[model samples]
Target chain A: MSRRVRDRKRLEGYLPPEGVPISFSIASIGARFGAQVLDIALTYGFIILLVYAMVTTGALPIEAMFALIMLCVFLIRVPYYILAELVWNGRTVGKRIVGIRVINAEGRRLTPHQIVARNLMKEVELFTPVTMVFTVDAMSGLGVLLTLVWVLAVLIVPLANRRRQRLGDMVAGTIVVDNPRNVLLPDLALSLPAQGSVPHVFDFLPAHLDIYGRFELQTLEKVLRDPVRGEEPPDFGQISRTIIRKIGYADPVRPGQERAFLNAFYRAQREHLETLRLFGNRREDKFHSAPGS
Target chain B: MTDAVAEQDKRRTGSSPDSPAAPAPQGELLRSARFRVEREGHWRRLDELVVRAEKAGPASLSYDETRELATTYRQAMNSLSVARDISLDRALLDYLETLCARAYLVVYAPQESIGGLTGRLLSIGIPQAVRRSALPLLIGFLAMVLGAVAGYVLFTGDPGWFYTFVPPDLADMRTPEASVDYLRSTIYGNDFDAAETLAAFSSYLFSHNTRIAILIFSLGIFLALPSFALTFYNGLVLGAFFGMFAVKGLGYDVFAWLSIHGVTELAAICIACAGGARLGLAVLLPGQRTRRDALREQAHDAVKLVILAALMLVAAAFIEGFLRQLVQDPKMRLAIGWGIGALWLAWLLLAGRSDEKQANEARGGSAP
Candidate 1:
């Protein structure tokens, strides 16, 4: 099974070194909605604070103050949303707290125009309907009906999709992903033999570690992790042989010792990179690093 | 058995001594032990640095530590790929993915400044985007005109059609049942307090029209159905009013009243609808790209158009509230309307293009 996955990876060598495609987990709708609500609350809170500051200090007349507050609710809302997303790399304070982020579905850097378009659409999606609801006397029945249709349509769109992208996300080529979490587990935990044997039994040159970098090291971590996990222990003999050849090891790997061989390589490579890293030299990739310091 | 197949079978069973299947192979175990002995330390060191960086921001690291962190990250990345090819542990693989994601965010994600963002959007971005989205814009404009023509025919042929087009509250004092004097009074407002009244009136108009245009732009996602209906209904109301005034022999009076702001207001509405239609078509047709991709591409233009239209609506509102009431003569109103309309057209179509041309020429001239 592992052999087949290896062959497939080699066939698609032009792809990124990790070989597997990275896909973001779509954020939950509840989280997304919560973030939006928080964002709106924050915006209102700021507006109230500003109004209070202005009024107490007698900075402007009451009529002008009233107009300014009204103006902020309407005109400044879109600018606020757009500016927040733009400055924070598609994160608003609300989103950051909720652990969700907006990203271009195309996997490229999001442009300013995309950000503006989506936030501007929020007027129809969220603000206008909300305004209509508040100003019931001012809005005609027809206007209210249209606002409902507009808001409902925008809301239903994301719910209808597997990706949970809102209307703005669809139009702007963006998706909200659950912000990735990194939990740092000790590196050599696996190297400690389960049977109480000494883990520090193997020894090799720094050059053995040089053959692999972070990309390969990560793949090694997965391979080592899989064996003790699932119901079926996958066959790794062909894969082990291939790695031994690739790394140019002279000794022939024993039949059952494939997993251990790979795990050892993982440990050695990780340690070598970290030690080299302690010095000034940086190895960005296989070709672009200072010669052994 | 062939050596590779034998190796493969041994691997499939169990590597441990307690395994049900055959396993006792010293050479493979020895080879594995030898490899682990050499490179384990480097991998562990990299992992420790990654842990620290992940726990705090990359900023928590010293200058030397940060440099080490980057190197460790790259090495770990390469190791992941090798491990995958070699069929190593799966836990190690998942951990590396986590590490890479953390590192990528710090290294690759760009946090832009607010001033830079505003400057880019204001400069050539909005206009150039609009110019590219010609097809949807044309469709959106035509839908509004189509509604207008239909509205005129329906309302002129049947006066009751006004009820269908204009809601009672929106129609206000401009009903056909109202006397000519009442309609005239409605347009002129209280002359005693014209300045303050007109300011309030224009603000109302601007907000009203701006909201409508914004609604049309946003609702375009429903395959542009709402946008079409909205612009069409607006046109219908206007057409019905025109038909009513014409019947009352106050056609010129109504024309003067509307002309000052109507030209810019109508054009903006039409433009906004066009933007909406682009969004709809991208969804409905999607062309060569995926539906989402097409919407995204069209949205860039549609959004720019919406922004432009909203601004025009404001200008029109100002004219309608202030200038429309002040400019009594039909000829003068028409002149002002035409001048503003032409200026907008020139700006949308030519402003950015000419600027780009000059920039290109300057670059060419500067070249050796």
Candidate 2:
């Protein structure tokens, strides 16, 4: 059971100084890559727009315009990252959209110092090599080789670790985790009865209810929740018969009434297991003998 | 039916049927229905508030809403813990966990005003950090000095070393073989387009120096060797340039020209390297703490130092762009350079000592 749980979402555990253990679902690399692409696209598009606006204005000589573009690029892009992360609490515009946010690995409040440290690293990792390629030596073999090596190192550093932290994140001790907006679904145990139909009731003797346990109850709950099938509606009749025979249920479940019967059985079996759980005799599945046997 | 058969097949091969014996709950069953019925309203309200807060900010909430947010967050945290213990509803646990996590992030975010933060960073943060890492700062300066001496010696021995020390484009007309008059003209040259060029020059200097400072700080993570080498190389370039002028007997003039800006710029470089060296040292000698812990602790101070250095570089660029050309007199230039340097020194030594002492006391009696 624990192995199955662990294989679900990869969780990074954080033990705060106050000793509260919090686990975050690590954002997938694909999602992070997508966010970066969006951010880069937006930043470059904005820079191009600014340059184009200035050029059309015809306000200065070519040399001056060139200098102004350089200044704008530095001023706009660098702060767009550092300031945006600071103000939005570790989320960039792209990060917000993609549902991932950076947090301190220690689970402490994100500090401005950390924000600046990480973003400055972006310059070293990405921008400097790019600038070198364009301005220093556009076509030199050595320059291209150097850039390729640097880029590869930057790319591989994250893949080398389980945390998916790039060089900046490692230095600053931050990690990006999925920040999803989730809604509490209505309780399955209560929903069917509230559909304006008469509440279906099923009574089972202790021996009949004691045949199953939590594991089987959970599987039954899954069936009750998702009745998805192709071409036609789910054949609840077959499921109801198998379950009825397994428990040697006494009631006659009509073909159309199987769902209602199943719902009642789920409620009763859950209640039985929960009661047994309270009595220190919790059953895991039907294969296990009842406690005290 | 097919799914059920597959599940039965898996069950036969799954964990052995002998269920592990363990203590179970001793009280009434915490039915998911009852729990949801009682708490669903609060969860929905919290969900609404968190959504609004995420879209805008926490400040977007009214006073009552803010109070409600806090109360509801605590209540949600309680719900999460309770659900973890008693409820087997995976969906409920997942929802509550996410809710509490979101609320925790929102509620515990730093609440400092921008004005207070900026004042603090300037008045004490930079100076205190510089004071703390004095050894690294000294080492950084010494490395530069050694490199400068090396460059001077090599250039004096062979004039060709000047070309090797300085980039060809930057050397322009300032070579050792250039006429002394031409060397003087480049320094005092205020042509008709001086204003136009100065604007570009200042921007270039600011961007270039800031980039170098950032690079030096970043490379400090790798044992500080790279940072030391870069700083030393910068010093070599400076020393070689000065050697070229000294050979022409215009050493004082060139010294004045450089000191006007180099005093601040070079100090800025040293500070940046100091930040990097501090990072390297943390990795080398973590002492009692783990290397990661040391790096994190020292990085806070290092970042402040580097940021201060970057800001100082901007100031230096402005002085170099305008004042160096306008103040042609070597003596006045020296006075301004030393004046700025002295002010920086005074600021570093004394800026926020009293304030820091009080903060230290408030934190827990004596300073570390």
Candidate 3:
């Protein structure tokens, strides 16, 4: 097979397979819900406590205290989520334990800008006039009424979203996912060695297939291989060619420069693998380790 | 023998490369191994991988594999999650929007329902109860001090200002000779006509004093400066009047005459002023709370203190209008003034003790 055919086949592999369905179990949904609540509680709880302490101690007067508390709440909220996602790569302490993470609509890890955008929009979530009413009524008989309204707003988010995103999540271009327990086998293991480096190509899979399939493949590969090995492995060009040929692409280039092609293919594969390592590998203990599972 | 049989069974299961089942080993191994596919069209392979993972022990995936798989699994999970979330968002948004609109109507619209009004009123309870009561109490105390100071100053000063404030018919009665004649007549004659005339004059005095007090209290809205001015003017007038009578050697007699009703009446007016000042302060310096919020709080406090002041004013009116006339002797008036002042002070201090007692009872009852 020619290098051209192998490259085309690699590109073709990007398309989603037919009839591969996407679904979420009730349990998974519940887990996601639990994770969301936990994240909110952990992130916001400390700020609320701090404010309460300040007010109680008379270290801050009511007006100044409230302003400071709100500012702190706003500042801490988004950064908390962003840092957790970046460090844990999408999982908060709770999310990590529950084996779920947030990602963009395309099943990719969140960009830093995206994280900031989503987290900062928490201000929008809090932008209702009711908060003002509550503050105004704080010294009146109407305080209880305002408090009730505020509580209702806070509790309503998870119940309202299918994904259980509170108002903040809606503004953030992100979604939570259950970390798949299945392993992903590296592409090198799956690709045939006769073909040169696969061309850089884009593929649009059915959304579910892209998320679930990639997760499974990566998990499987990691399970089988020792990622810490020091020596370089054999060229994957021939395997790439074979896989391409099997996938039904025709060759365009002669096979005489197999060695040179193999070298290029290996280099590309290593780079791709490194990128995946940076963005992909999730810590198991963080999320998917359910009790008694 | 068991090994031989197992080997033969493996061969029969297409372990041989020539057999169709031979493809199953590679497929099974690939399937058993965990993998994440980032590229698009890998669904068939993904399905096969899923099948393999499922068939293999669930724990076949390594820790990293599990993390990678979790992402894909979550992606699939999110499809349903997103759909569910969208519907939930619509419902919540609708509910919140309705609430927001209702709040706006209650605050901005006049044609609100009684229930809505009540709700709005009730919302003020927490803030009023917690933070507002102080304004009225503080203002009331301050006003009393100011009124007292003014009264002392005026009564101890020259009586020139007294002539301006007292009606002409009443002014003629202030002369030293007439004052002595009137005192003798009141003691000796003790006639109904004299008593009636004195009662009428006292009524006028009571009404006039209460009106001035109310005016001073209400003027706080103009700002803190006005309140002080009104307070100071009342003080100056009182001082001048007192001073004139003292110079004339009639100061002790006048003090006795005034003390009976003056204590409660003056205290009540001062309380009213305090309440008004509190309201003004709320407007001037809202602090962290909004101006509206502060104003509402102060208004509540001021209203309570005003009610209490009105009650005190009524007490003072009764003493000045009727009781003073019944007692003709200066000595009797002095005794009555002290007695009434004591009673008023007792009432003020002890009026709310019952609430504390009730609260204690409730707490005790609930303790067990």
Candidate 4:
């Protein structure tokens, strides 16, 4: 391949692993959900504690206590979901910790309007009182039977959806997905080495290059250094060949000659530079750094 | 020179080049490069350093590492040609965080659902309270109304009975001639002009009624007896006033005049009283729950009712101050009152119904 073409290919972003299926274990999903809850609880808990302390100390009125509680609950819970979904990309405090988040069925960030629509359903959940009993004893007796109707009306709608969306989600134009692992890579800082003495050269890459190039470089670094630690190390030659094919390269490297080929190729460029210096009269040294120097 | 040659030899071997014999310059460069790469590689290891720093009291990550990670992520984002790819990356990060949050919830608070257990309780708890209180509220209102009417009729039959019911302080204000002239004059009597007097009277009555309603609702700590007594007394006075007028052949006119503001104001007072009664009852009979628990539950219901009461009072004040005064004809007044009553009924039943479907949708939707 021409040098320019190779450089162009190198600049391409890291390709996501195909067919890996970004499915998360139920345990992980639960952890993420829990984290969000904790975040809210902590936030609201602090506010409530502050209010309670004030009220008890007579710094605030008892009526203010009620108002404050109501305010905190509304402000914290409503915006917690909406803003987190919209801005934080669906992971609340707990969700962030557990490595799970909400996304569209197609695995995309939700819009603000969608977040608002989904959150307003909270009022419905607040106003309706009979729905909870339905869950407790759907099959027990006549009361249970009646409660079942109410429960069915509320809960059944969401169950019918492929994405398990409730009426609000449907109206709001959103879906919740398990936070896919690929999104976590950036936050995980997986591209950079975690610990070492060497000054990273990749940092010098100009910022104007698109995210794809940066990702590619980072991925290249990771792949080079980490190299998947179990079993026999992946045959770099075969792997490189497969990557090349996947990326639309036509030439294939032969087995057992991959390392020699790379070394010779780098060396040939260095020798070519020497030839340029010895024969062709270039005013200044044309080649600064030797290949693989 | 010997050491430099040895270091070069070591570099050729590539066997842990940080060996003691490695040349200072080469070793330093290699070490720094290796360190930088390793340091920048992963979040988990970086987090370990942070954790250690925290354990040791205070620590922070290197600024260079922070900047590098940020740049890398930004680059990844910019590289995406397809919105779908960027979305997927965002989704992955979101998922990871959510997983962490969910794990925390499971460990710390297993009971909370996305809608929250409090929300569930509110859904069931409020309506249940309302339904339970509805019978008592209706019965109490009806009984008071009937008692007032009965007392009015009996007292008017015997004019002397007025003194028995009326307090000594208010007795002198009554007219012996049994006239509408006296009541209208009393209502309109003031240094101000008739319009001003009427307006001020309406405003005073409207505010007084509201204050009384608020007091009844808020003084649940006193077991609500004061509020019930106040309701009963007001009802008796209303019945007596109407019965006296009916005896004088002015009952129809009086009914219209009273109802112009009475309907909403009375209803609001009753609602407030009902809220107070709920609180009192919760205190008196803490059924399956403890007193505090019952009080808390009752307080929630009472608050909703109080809000409803406040709305009604505002309607009452508007009618009393503007509508009632503008339409002096008794028939017109009655029609307006009835219209307001109908409007209130419609609202109580239907105001928030349009969003019911949306609310249900929300409940059913995924936690995302």
Candidate 5:
């Protein structure tokens, strides 16, 4: 079941071998559409520039004219999306600006065949309907209907799933995700009897503190910040359990006091790490080295 | 030899100043804040290093800088997990998530062109796939021949069979009443408009036939019935045309006209049908695996067949438009048609085998 969840997100989560989860929020449809629009605009701009260049080279020999026309046909037919994603590490310029990236849906690296299949399918998904409209005068009624069906089939695909993946994403086994950004730590204030006033209520271990560092610290902070979604109940129990298992902590927190327990752990770990740093030693991850003399 | 720490020293100015009252001889809240503040410098420093690396490949990073980047990356990741578990600050969490995402991709995803996969596919993949589907291809070819024979026999017995099978627009000039002079001209015409008309005709055939090929391959998802019907219908049209010409005593002339491109064009159509049949069989009969697994296994070959069929149709269109026009003699057309048929057979059976051996040798050389 955990495997299914990981697969659904196209997550390359930290296994025993890999050592950490790779998580990113999937990009919503609006952002993807915006990038596509920018790409289309650029492609058209390029074609017009080529045409202008061809016209300026006046009286191009007959052979040159044929070559120019062929160039235009090639430009018109090929979408540069494949090349853009290939060269830009899964980002086109528009995608880079919008803070999204394409990745294989299976949590594997992108392959050339997948890239080609997805882009070529775009001809049927987007371009066929467009070209049909452009050549409407020549098409029979059945052809028009078929074109409409093709467009409809592709348009509804993104809406039918939580991932907001189009037919292209499904066929290519890829997903779009937000680019990573820098994390800030929130002001941590959960009202308990100030510091030592509640000393008997909980306990900590320096070794327990040693199990995590800044990376997991920020991730925990994000979870603690937003415990509830729009309608679903909060899942703090699972989150707490995962952290316990991940860090090899010996005991689970009291059932309902998951948040408070996590906060106490947070304070203990921070002080423990800061004390070490003061002694000219700074621990990083679970495998942090050498104790201060 | 090592100025990475010095480089990091110069960029340490970006950490927020107010964040640092954090020696934390005090409150739990104060400690977490100090945690954030103290670690903020590494995040900023790593981000700067990453920006440089992203701009100028990872190889450009100094040894110390690379170590710092790795150590800082792990630390940032830990901070993200901690922040999510304990903090309620949305902005901080968002920043952490984004930073982690960027860092993960830059660290893990390979940096290289994928040109080799495409090159391999074009050179060896399609032919090998075609070779594997030989039995299904033969079966599909037999089905089309059966359909053609049925259409020819039925049309010869009754002219209405031709009208029923062949669309009026396509059969416009090829009807029984078309003059011998006119029938001859379609194969060996000299008018200026003849070239233009043939060019338009070939493009129309290319799009129409290619569309059918793609549709047939995809429609195999529905137990392959539609694919069978479509292929049979295509054969029926050809048979009906031949049957009509036979009735008018122009069968030999018409055969010559068709032979030049028909062999390749028809073989392509049959391959597409076979691709669909192979898919149907996968879903209909799974020897040991689940049905879905069987379908998945067959899909690559099916896609290769679809793509190859489209390519052959394009080649056929060119042959039909230009070369067929030039070689209008009946014997020459038959020779060219049979020659192409033999070449396609030999190529499919033999071409990619050599490449397969070469690739295996290359892999062997690298393995040890």
Candidate 6:
């Protein structure tokens, strides 16, 4: 991958407390927006339900009602962001569901101070400006204009940066990143046919295996592993023909046996690359000349 | 076989005396298979632990499971490094990297107990931060004072200047046109049921002031000039309001009225601005350090001040809501205002002094 692309995707070279430099993908703006929308919906939905309940109960005097609602919103919304993040290690309910999380930009354990600072900043960057826009005296052009400007500025900040950090994130030195949970698949080489057991329909000799490298092997494995779909599956016949032609194999691959031919070639190529790696003759791609060749 | 094929095959699967797979050239794929077979148990175990931890908190793990997690994490890290060096399977390496990253996040997460965090925040963290950013605090305070003086002078000289300094919505009916008696009523006003409305008033004031404080602090990222400007403008509003009353010779009453909560509220604003000011100044002039480094370093204190200021605003809101209109005596108002101010000053200055050394050590221990 290109450095710029990798940098855009992953937070490179982050040293965790363990002192090992690791990297994680930066969450896409799309995911962040989705999480934010979910959060806003949930919080606002909650506040609406609460206000409805309070209004229906009539236990509170009309004069105190507004204040009670304000108190409820302030109490519920602020703590929901700050305390939830703290307890869940920078994940809110929406963030957890969306599979993204906030982390310290410096790769330290995220501090409570950072969490509070960032969330409070949301008051300015998002909540306040939005409320101001609605409540602004429409007659005063400047008031509406200023609110719009603030809203636009906040929106643009994240788009302009590689980290996709909004102003709050910048101030608090935090970034939102994808929470990955990839499972390790069994080694593909383990599926290779056993020696001296069921004679394979096709065999890949050393010459055929050596013609390809790790990259080609992986590409071929991907093709082989892809499940056949619909009436017209991938043209394994054409693919096998190309590989056979490229490797200068004299034998012909049977029409229906193309998949088996490719599978045999994949196993052989992977074995060849793994053996080369053990001997420190790692081949990155077809363009990467094998060691001593 | 062709000479080249035999030669390549022989070289590819070099001799291994202890031969299980090494005996046959085709069987040399055993290297990666063998590696996975040997260590798959640890990888699987670690994966299970991480999944469980993520689903629930680490507390869900048994003591033995926790110990196993540590060892498995180390082993995973080692495997990742070695795989990067020698493994040709990109999938395996990618899997290990992800595993290690997740494990690391869980393992080294800020494990500071909640009680310790709260104690430190109230005692050492907030006060030390306040003390460290004294320069910004002074600058913020002075900006407000200067703005207040400018506003007072301008409004006193020209009544028309009231429109220029204060927004109509904020000024409410406390305009130049209103009678002194009417303005006085606002200060001692209880037209609305005080007990019923005061709760709303307190919450409104709390949310509003907290929003402004947060805004000032966040705006500090833009070189702090905005923070200074915002603080000064607030001062202008106050000065002009006071000027209107001062013109009618109810200046002391107005001062007393505001002092009921103004001391805490205004101080909280200044402290919040100071948080922003420190942030702006650090970015503007990061001496001997990169701007990013300076910002990251200074942000700790700035955020602390903002949070502390926010809490202070909450208290100010309550006092203003409950007492400003209820307590009719000017002398009592002034005493209470100053009393609250004195307590805040004392707390900021002295609350964490006893544990200064201990606080530093505790903070250092928790920090990466």
Local accuracy by lDDT, each model: 0.67, 0.76, 0.45, 0.48, 0.66, 0.79
Q: Stretches of candidate 1 above 4 Å error? A: A1-23, A45-62, A121-156, A183-293, B1-76, B79-96, B109-135, B150-160, B190-204, B320-322, B325-330, B354-368
lDDT of 5 by residue, B49-141 (tens): 777776666778989988888888888787776655443344656677667666666666645555776677766998888887877687668
How would the docking of model 2 be graded?
incorrect
Docking class of 5: incorrect
Instruction: Between candidates 1 and 6, name the one with more favorable lDDT.
Output: 6
Q: Write the per-residue lDDT of candidate 6 for residues A166-267, one digit (tens) a residue.
A: 877876789898997777765655553323333334555666666777777767765655355654556887898888888888776656666566656665
Candidate 5 lDDT score at position B213: 73
Per-residue error (Å), model 4, residue B338: 1.2
Which scores better on DockQ, 4 or 6?
Answer: 6
Please provide, for model 6 over B1-368, each residue's C-alpha lDDT reduced to its tens digit, 9 standing for 90 to 100: 01211233343422222223223454354455555566778988999999898778788899999999999998888777666655656568778888988888778764334668988799888988898888999988987898899889999999888999899988888899999899988888777566778878888999888878888887887799999999999999888989999999899999999898999999999999999998899899999889877887788899899888888999999898888877899999999999999999998998778787787799899976
* Candidate 1: CAPRI quality band: incorrect
Error of 1 at A43 (Å): 3.1
Model 3 chain A: which ten-residue window has the lowest total lDDT? A7-16
lDDT of 4 by residue, A106-128 (tens): 23334443454455443233223
Ranking by DockQ: 6, 2, 1, 5, 4, 3
Q: Which numbered prediction scores highest in lDDT against the true structure?
A: 6
Each model's backbone clash number? 66, 0, 102, 80, 48, 1
True contacts reproduced, candidate 6:
0.42
Model 5 ranges with Cα > 4 A deviation:
A1-17, A31-101, A119-171, A179-293, B1-93, B111-114, B135-143, B161-172, B191-212, B276-295, B354-368
lDDT (C-alpha) at residue B144 in model 2? 84
Error of 4 at B63 (Å): 20
The candidate scoring highest on DockQ is 6
Q: For candidate 4, give the lDDT of residue A38.
A: 80
Runs of candidate 3 with Cα error greater than 4 angstroms are A1-293, B1-209, B354-368
Candidate 3's TM-score on the B chain: 0.51
lDDT of 2 by residue, B1-368 (tens): 11211221111111111111222132222255566556888988998998888777788899999999988877777677655545556568768878877777777753334567778899989888888888999978987898888898888999899988899888886788889899989877776255767767887888888888888888888788889999999889988888888988888988998899999999999999998999889888999989877888888888898988988998998898788878889899999998999999999989999888887678676535
